[model samples]
Target chain A: MIELQHVTKVYPSSPRPALDDVSMQIDKGEFVFLIGSSGSGKSTFLRLLLKEDSPTKGVIKVNDKTLNTMSKWQVPKLRRTMGCVFQDFRLLTNKTVAENVAFALEVINKPQRTIKRVVPEVLEMVGLDGKENRLPGELSGGEQQRVAIARAFVNRPLVLLADEPTGNLDPETSQDIMLLLERINRTGTTVVMATHDYHIVDSMRRRVIELNDGILSRDQSRGVYGLGR
Target chain B: MRVNFVLSEVAAGLRRNLTMTVAMILTTGISLGLMGTGLLIANMIGDMREIYYDKIQVSIYLADGITDPQRDAIAAQLDSSPEVKDYLYESKADAYARFTQQFQEQPALIANTPQDALPESFRVELVNPQRYPVIAEQFPNGQNGVDEVRDEGDFLDRLFSLLNGARNATIAVAVVQALAALLLISNTIQLAAFNRRNETNIMRLVGASRWYTQLPFILEAALAGLIGALLAIGGLVLTKILFVDKTLAGPIKAGIIPPVDWSAIAAISPVIAAAGVGLAAVAAYVTLRLYVRL
Candidate 1:
């Protein structure tokens, strides 16, 4: 579960707050879609959730842990419970698919035996079982995204935050990636994805949260992309 | 935390940036070598000072026509002088014998010297060599039985000043070279971090701690520094065997200059190694903090 109470983030160079006194909550095991145009504060919202940038004023709680009061050393621990995927698959080009996926557990000081056993199982879950040795450059866009997803899910984080994960993929590949995310969400991990793709948003009909100029415009359950545009 | 994983990362990093790593190692080696040389020179200077200063004496040469009564009067005065710690009266024959013994290796030089050419003198050792001027004033040159009074301390002072200058210059050059080495290490670390930005970014996304991401870079720099230190120790060992022992054997054997002992090199080896490792690791850590986010 994630909770934001009147969170407002203002960059010093900017004239307005990126997130203006917004409050929201999402329970566990929910698939949420965050839709907005460019510079709609969508990325800012995700960044605040990751604690990459602090909210200028307000509190954020992830799984009942207050992020504002979290010590600097605890940020990494907080991040460990939440998986993150970016628009750019962000895979290590030199590492094989299995290595990239195992990297997550490795950084957390996972045992070698666990890494060895779990990397293949997660790779198989993401449909990357046969391509374990292939480099990211050798994979297609959808497959690379799958690799990224597998890496994020390898540790079975409590929540998954994705930002424009399918920004570079074609519509067909985007649907496949959406299906993969849907599958991941069904495993009781809360999923929050931010995107500008109207087609995918309309097709899925998940809970839609729209942001308009840093304001929370809508929070609709089983909502279409352009329902109240 | 995993030793093999971190080590493999370090090796991969070093191999990935082989040229930079070599540059860092060579620069670190040259600087540390110079520093070790400076330390050795300082040690030698200290030993030489002890040897030369301990033997510092004021010699008062007697006149060629001096009678026994005048010499006896001078000896009586020297024996009662509070400034003199000890004095040895060397006759003309005694002086000639000492000269012959010193020049025994060069038979031609000893054969050319006449017996009476050497002067009878009192070799006066003072409590403090710096008080040579007091003895010189007491035993004036060209007075009574004294032909000339000279202080060996003056020549030793000049020699030590020259040696000190050389030591200071070597240390100065070593410091500058160390600075250059530090800058090269900073640049190399920055380049390494930049090259691996993508991997590090993903690592961060997966909750890798900042130190975890930065460890490989720090270890790479440290490993290079350690190797550089080993090279510097080797250079010092080589210098001692090839140059000091081989080239300066005559002076060292004659006790004109002190020998470069193996123990001296051994003593300063750890210091040089620590400097290499500490400076490179610090430089890499600082570079990461200032320039690279990951």
Candidate 2:
């Protein structure tokens, strides 16, 4: 479902490349953990996958389409097929939980009937059915993360790229988010999550790709974090 | 993408930046008002030119005790001149009667004037009003029966030039104010975008197109512009009713200045509205393109 061949990304005014000649592949329906410390090119990897920024060299193919050759107008269409969740949860603070989930569908121009039917079902799946009208500020951190996950999954995207989904949560709350993500993965949504949380990484034995100094150092099946880095 | 969603977002954004929105509306209103005033002045100048240019005349006053033969000779010269299109010889009694009629509203001034105090003159319309110097050269002042040759067109020229200068000054000030209004609109749009950056970022991630995220800010600017245009039109209407119609009634009634009718205001109303909305929307779009990421 995803392939990167010798991708190199060098930002202007920076001494070194953000990602240097990195190549990797992930099959469909795989829950992969991208383990790296800060400035280790984890976020850069996800950004390239989303086509938010083009690689300086080499090629990236997501779902059989070469991202490097895609036109600018097609970028939004490509992103519509994949959902993204950030470390900050990125919820519209003024909106209620249900409105936040519906926002994703609305952005894609979904019909009102579809948005009405899908929003509630996704909220139910994420365990936020009853708190539809509660704003993000009124919700707990765990609940807010659940809203973000609901928003990501509302459209039933092919792949979910999460950048430190539980970075701001407590340890117990982080486990709940991990379990929710794992549940989403089991339902045939490929998940690529970047994180520095070792406990959640070790608890879930999945395909792990580790980055060190802009290079792919390890790729292991049924892997744990901090074992090869 | 959805119209309702875009509209709701616009409403929310306007509410969030209510003060800035109001400021933008008032600024746009003042700018558009000045522009409308400039346009009205230009139209009035055109009308006044049409009315006055055709009526411009040069009056050649006679000496106090000029003989009939000298008056006849002057008349013969005026009739033979190619520059004179037409001429009216006003006797002293005729001049005094015209003076009384002109100052009828000021009875006291008319009463103070003697019956024969006004001079007998030849009111000559030139083939081209600009050929006044030619007539003055033909009949020199203090020669023949000509006491002094007065070109009314010259005074009208100076008056119209002063009016034109005032019109140009008004338009220049209006241009500067419009520029300030555009800058304020750009700043307001930037602030609105910054305040909602988090929402915009999420929209971008959730597959909203850049245009979809930008629609709300653009719509907010357009809405303010629309309101400002309506206010400016209202201001113009009020000025016409309270100031022009009421305060300047005497001059308009006496035909000193042309009346600004409803049709004239109607002619420029759509232009003002279009300018207000179009300028504000363009400014907002440019600001977003140049400064805001989304």
Candidate 3:
């Protein structure tokens, strides 16, 4: 579950607020699409949820824990409950696919047995079971993104955030990635995806929250991307 | 398992930035070596000061043509003087014997010296060695069979000051080199952090604590520092063996300078090592805090 109460974020270098007077609550296990144009506070919303940056004026609560007053030391614990997938599929290039997924567990100080058991399972779930030893650079764009997803999901975080997960993938590969995300959402992990892909959004018909010029424009149950533009 | 992972990360970081690591290690090693040299010189100066200060004396040499009465009067005057704690009358034969024994390593100098060529003098030790002027005034030269009144304390002062200057110069240079070494370490850590920003970002994203992301960089600098310290110790050992023990053997054997024994080097090695490791690790930690997010 995620909740934002009148969250307004204004970066010092920029004149306008990135997110202005935004109020929203996402229930547990919901698949939500955050629809917005560029610079419409989509990434800022995700960053706020991740606690990477704090809102200039607002409160954000993820999984019943208020993030506004969260101490610096507790940010890592907060991140442990959430998974983040980026457009670039930021895998360690020098590491193998298995090591990349295992790295998430390793950083969290998981036991060797757990890492060994969970890494391959997650890689297999992301459809890279046989490519454990391959480097990220050697993989295709879709395969690399799968590796990223495997890494994010390896810890079994409660919430998964995908920021333009299919931004670099072709249409067919993008649909496959969406199917994979939908599969993940079905396992009771709340998924919040931020994107500009209208075809994927219209076809999926999930809950859509649209942002326009840093303001909440529409919140529709099972909405399409271009409805309010 | 976590320990192995962290250690592997440290190893990979060091390997990835091999040239920077090598540069940092060499800088640290050279600086720590100079520091060790400075410490050794300080220890040697301390030993030499103790040896020379304990036996410092003023010598009033007699005129060659002086009578027995003149020599006896000079000796009696030295004995009765309040400034003189003790005095020894070294006859011509005694002076010649001491000179020959001191230069025994150079037999040519002793072979050319005649027994009567050395001066007969009274070597006077004062209670307060700084009161050399008082003794000198009491035994004015050219008056009471005293040809020259020389205060060994004066020569010792000049000599110790020269050695102190050398020690100070070496330490100053060492301090400068240490600053350069610290800067190099800071820059190297920053560069290493920059190069691995993507990995660290992912690590942070996946619930890796900031310390977990940073430990590898700190450990990399510390490992380089540790190796640098070992190299410095080796340099010091080599210098002692090659330069101090071998090249300066004559001075040490002749008692002109005290020998730099193994214990002195062994005593200061831990300090050098701690300095190398502590400075580098601290530099890296501080650089991470100030410049790099991780």
Candidate 4:
């Protein structure tokens, strides 16, 4: 669950604010999408949600913890409960698919037994079962994305924040990935996906929040991502 | 939390940056080896000084045809001299007897010689042979038929000065090389860190602890240093045993130059081994401190 109250951010060199007093809330077990154009505040909103950058003005809460006021020391602990996927898969090229997923557990100092057990199941669930031994280079773009998904899910984090999860995949592959994300959401983990993909946004008819030039322009339940001039 | 996991990561990291690891090893090895040389030379100088000061006895050859009154005056002067530990006056007859005994192979020559042909001498021992100048100066241009005073310790002083110079030069050279190696290894590790920046980021993102990310790099550098140090230690032993002991030790033992302090060289090997591993770890930690982020 996430809540941003009057959150605003401004970069020193830019006149236009990246997020203009954006206030929104996302509930547990909810599937949501933040849709906008190229310069939309979608990514900025996600960054704030992940606590990667502090907001200039206001409070943002995730899992009942107010991130805006949390000290630097507490940020990593906050992130432990959330899974994040980037536009670029961000896989370590040197690590195999299993290692990439195992990386998540490793950071948490998970036991080898847990890693050996969970890594394969997560890989299998994301359709990368036998390919665990293969490196990222050996996998296709879609499979690489699947590996990323498995890594995100392996920790069984409370929330999943994705910034363009399927931007590089074909539409059909995108649907398959979205279906996987939807299945994960059904398992009671919150999902906040930020994207410029109109079709998937329109097709899902999930709770939608649209941002335009750093302003939250729409909030609708079971909504399509259409709110143009 | 797991030491083995940290070690495995370290092993993998070392494997990843093989060239940098090797460079760190060589840098540490060369620095420590030079340092060991300075230490060994300094110790050897100390040993030489010890032996020379302890064993060098002064010889005072008495003048021929000296009367008992002259001997009495010499004995009076010797008794008051601060340099003398103990001195015994050997008569001409006693000198001839000693010569005959020492040169037993030529007993006939000694049996035919008259006592007057041998000179009366004072066999003098000093309080400290290093204070040889004290007694040697006493009999200079002999006032009481004291022919000459001799102490062999002056030669050791010259040798000590030479070794001291060598030790100082080795220390200076080692310091310069140590700094240069530090800079070079720092750059190498920096480049290696840059190459793995993404991996570091991912680790940070995944909630890996600071040491979790750094332990591997440090261990890799340490392992490389360990290898280099072992090589240096082996080389040092080989130099001492094969070259120093076998060739130089024999010639020098017969007093051509000076005997090698082999125990000192042997003592240096373990320190070099420890230094090798220490330098590698330090380099790793230092480079990481300057360039890496948790």
TM-score of 2: 0.92
DockQ (Cα-based) for each candidate: 0.73, 0.71, 0.73, 0.46
Model 4: residues with Cα > 4 Å off, grouped in runs: A1-27, A35-77, A92-96, A129-139, A207-226, B1-12, B56-76, B81-142, B146-158, B250-263
- Fnat of each prediction, in sequence: 0.66, 0.71, 0.85, 0.41
Q: What would the per-residue lDDT of candidate 2 be over residues B84-158, giving only the tens digit for each residue? A: 899898999998887776666678988999999999999998998878888999889998868999988788889
lDDT of 4 by residue, B22-78 (tens): 776677667777888787777767766666555446667777656789878878887
lDDT of 3 by residue, B1-294 (tens): 378878987888888889988999999999999899989999998999887777657888888998999888887887787887988888999999878766777898888888899999888889888898888888788986789999887898899899989988888988999999999999999989988898888888888898888888988999999999999999999998889988888778877799998999999999999999899899999999999985
The CA lDDT at B100 in model 4 is 65
Candidate 2: where are CA atoms >4 Å away? B90-105
lDDT score, residue A91, model 1?
Answer: 88
Q: Summarize candidate 4's per-residue lDDT along A189-229 as a digit string, tens digits.
A: 99999987889988999998988899988889998877552
**Candidates by DockQ, descending order:** 3, 1, 2, 4
Write down the DockQ of candidate 3. Answer: 0.73
Interface RMSD of each: 1.0, 1.2, 1.4, 1.8
Error of 1 at A49 (Å): 2.1
Candidate 1, A1-229: lDDT as tens digits: 8999999999999998888888999999999999878888999999888888899998999989999998877888888989988789988888899998988898879999999999999888888889999999999999999999999999999999999999999999999999999999999999999998989888898999989889898999999888655
Query: Candidate 3: misplaced stretches above 4 Å?
Result: B66-82
Q: Write the per-residue lDDT of candidate 2 for residues A1-229, one digit (tens) a residue.
A: 9999999999997979999999999999999999887999998999999888999999999999999999977888888889988888888887899998998888778899999999999999989889999999999999999999999999888999999998999999999899899899999999999999888888888889999889999999988998543
DockQ result, candidate 4: 0.46
Measured with DockQ on alpha carbons, how good is candidate 1?
A: 0.73
Instruction: Record all residue pairs in model 3 with backbone atoms less than 3 Å apart, i.e. clashing.
Output: none
**At residue A65, what lDDT does model 3 achieve?**
93
